[model samples]
Target: MFSLADLPDTIPIFPLPGALLLPRARLPLHIFEPRYLAMLDDCLKTQHRLIGMVQPQEGSAMSAGRLHGIGCAGRVTQFSETEDGRYMITLTGISRFRFSRDVTGFSPYVKAEVSWPDFQRDLGGEEEDPDFDREVFLKLLSRYFEVAGLETDWSNLEEADDELLINSLSMLCPFAVEEKQALLEAPQLVDRRQTLTALMDFTCRGGSSAPDELLQ
Candidate 1:
């Protein structure tokens, strides 16, 4: 369990469209840009070692882009710096937060005041979601993979626990920004599962009326 006290009142955000992180999920990031490299340095020096992973809104201007309001905060766990000054870091997520507003002038990197009430449940370990529709999820996933011509280690996927399987697939799947936001904002694990189902169904069927799956 993460202590709320360890998190800062505000967090510096790294906004890369299509990249995402979720509570308890680990995301590998390449930090080559000067601003983010500086951000990583400050994190290593200060105890405020959490970075908020967010996405710039699709089709938005890169120079002065708008970000999706919700993002997950990740704690720096693995870090290594290359001779060329680039940093390869892995962030293990701590919790999800909603942006209150952007606050600037404190750092070269962008900063945002954020609130965590929506994701307090994330501080605790994820319990097995009784309502998870594993059969449907797998069926749609298999079909989606077939459509995309993507391959997976089926044996490894089968061995994953409920939380790992869901989070892993959600991260790996190339769902649209709106769909990804739906997964992040789901109120509970079961809800996220349902949202994943909807997104997968839409993607696999070319955004037609959602294809129905056998319910068990």
Candidate 2:
């Protein structure tokens, strides 16, 4: 368990448009772009190894896009360099933070001042949501996979805890940027489970709509 007091005052940020991460979840990122390669190099050198996983606001460009207030900070738990000079890394979530402000001349990638007060609970790990219905989730997931021509290891899905299942489903789903953000912003486990359930249903039925519709 990571302590909030150990959290940094500043960290490097990755402004991927549709990528989302949740606390205790693992996000695997391939560092190929020059800018991100530079960023990874810096992280390896300094050993800070913490990157903020955030989405660019909807309808915005990466260079000039506004970020949603919330994002998760992850630690580089796995790393390997390839012959092509590319780095493959896995970041395991440490905690969620809200965007406070940005500063210049920090690093090649974007940097931001972030606060974790709103999501301190995430540090405690995933809480069980009694109101959450796992059967419903599996039913919808089965239907969506069938429709999408996807397959799963039923045993693993059955053994996964609430947090793992929700984050895995949320991360793997081909939902839009806003939908991903909604999963990131859910106040707690039950809310995320509920939101994810709706999204799964919509996908199973081949329905598409805005994030707000699914949340509602």
Candidate 3:
């Protein structure tokens, strides 16, 4: 329930690779690392309880590396602490942000100054993709799944709404880190769908030989 005016200029960030959190989508995280566990503790102490989910650039060490320019900020909606000193939480995406600059601090986790103007539309309700061709996309998805040796409940996919279906696939698909960043930075639902379709098509056409091979 955060308005644009309510978001802070600085927030703690979690730089994870191959993880995507779209607006209104939920992401579950396991917080075990000492630093991240400290991050969870700090987040719970704040009113917004927002955490920025970003990706480290490809070919860079995950512990210390440059991050992608765009990322989503999620609010900690569900949280629980296990007996073994670990934290489990679910983040519901709030808005997408553009990275400004890293905020140097004594904290163990990374913090960044971010701006949210470009993705103001993300603050709205679920988006629509009227031009999405569900039948064709499903056919491609089925073929892609077969080639990748993955399985899913077609009935569930068929019943999902456009936003749910597309966002979930964009998040869950085993795309490369850069590809996931592309999906995260895509301007709109239609754009993401096209990007996703192209990626699946690429994978279906024996494009998996190189892990670094990206969609053109």
Candidate 4:
């Protein structure tokens, strides 16, 4: 297990319902709200201005919002302050964090003390499978795309690594709140991919059927 002591002190915290971040990928955030602005200020002053991206259970602002247990910490690699005092920030994920507890007495954004797991990444092993399972996933994803009438760069998507592909799709896909939470709480890349595959299959089948196969 990865220790909390190893994490950088004073990490950045982004608290929003239904948003998830995964490691080794980048997420762009538009920051205009006051609490997040205050968070940006606090991060800029610290040595490790890294931020943990988490989803709150309740759809409220800082007050009365409950954070989910899992999150990913990212470093602000690129940032631009807009003319209107808004910030367009790019967060590049560093590691996945499990919430140890929440830190209070700060601004609107809630900070969590976290612990991480020891994971080894094999960056060169990405591949496209033409088997039945992969075919089903692809077909489901296509249906999802058509249903939502969304356009994406298929070529670039086909080239993404497993973690990036699954997590990015999970974040952007029009899935339910519980479904998104499931994707966020999945322990590893393999498990997450499997869960996503199941979700896609169910969605493609057009059923709100119980996720019996997946939950098992």
Instruction: Name the candidate that leads on lDDT.
Output: 3
Candidate 2 per-residue lDDT, tens place, 1-216, comes to: 677787887888898887788888999989898888987787777655788998888788775258888899999999999998998899998888988888688466788899988888988956787876778778888998887788989899989987798888888888888898888888888888888888877776777754466543
Candidate 4, residue 11: how far the Cα is off, in Å: 3.3
Report the lDDT tens digits of candidate 1 across residue range 1-216: 577666677888888766778888899999998888988998877675889988677677432258887889999999998999899999998999987888868577887899887777888886478877677778788998988789999989888889888888777787666566667777777777777777777777687333334111
Please provide TM-scores, in order, for all candidate models, with all chains considered together: 0.90, 0.92, 0.95, 0.80
On the 0 to 100 scale, the lDDT of residue 45 in model 2 is 70
Q: Can you tell me which runs of candidate 1 are displaced by over 4 Å?
A: 62-65, 208-216
Backbone collision tally, model 3: 0
| Model 1 clash number | 0
lDDT of model 3 at position 106:
97
Candidate 3 per-residue lDDT, tens place, 69-166, comes to 88999999998989999988999999999989989989999989999988889998899999999999999999999999999999999999999999
Name the better of 1 and 2 by lDDT.
2
* Model 1's TM-score against the true structure: 0.90
Better of 2 and 3 by lDDT: 3
List ranges where model 3 is wrong by over 4 Å. Answer: 209-216
Q: What does each candidate score in C-alpha RMSD?
A: 3.8, 1.8, 2.0, 3.9
Per-model CA lDDT versus the true structure: 0.79, 0.83, 0.89, 0.68
